[model samples]
Target: MAGVAAIGAADLVAGFGLAGALVLPAEDPESVLAAWRSLPPDTAVIVLSDAAAEVLRAEPAVRAPDAPLTVVLP
Candidate 1:
């Protein structure tokens, strides 16, 4: 798991030219929340699953009290 996380972090830096963090998790809400929290303000989030988007949409903190969360679903 540690090795996988290292590789994923490396891949993100290599591909995105970002020293940004990447969180790959063992399960659902935790992974989703981690991804959400790790991203900076105004950054775009692209979700591969509609179901996951739905879950994300339901989180008030994810959307915020005033600002809408930007998510692209494929």
Candidate 2:
């Protein structure tokens, strides 16, 4: 379970049969967007707070048909 923050890191795991999970911070929408863009198709992105989820949903790029984005509220 590696924390990937860039496209290069995501590329490293390509074809390794590894599942990628991105845990995003609530306060940093830009970071979330960056991470979302960096991940490969089918990556599971978990947004930790509603604030972050809102931010993610607002970003048009985050709504990829092939990727799964989940919002986990506490």
RMSD of every candidate to native, in Å, equals 8.4, 8.5
Candidate 1 structure quality by residue, lDDT tens digits, 14-57: 33334342333313555655655555454443332344455567
TM-score of each: 0.43, 0.47
Off by over 4 Å in 1: 1-27, 42-48, 65-69
| Candidate 2 lDDT tens digits, 1-74 | 42432221223323233444343332366765665666655455443445555666676665666455554454
Ten residues in sequence with the least summed lDDT for candidate 2: 2-11
Please give the distance, in angstroms, between residue 18's alpha carbon in candidate 2 and its true position after superposition: 16
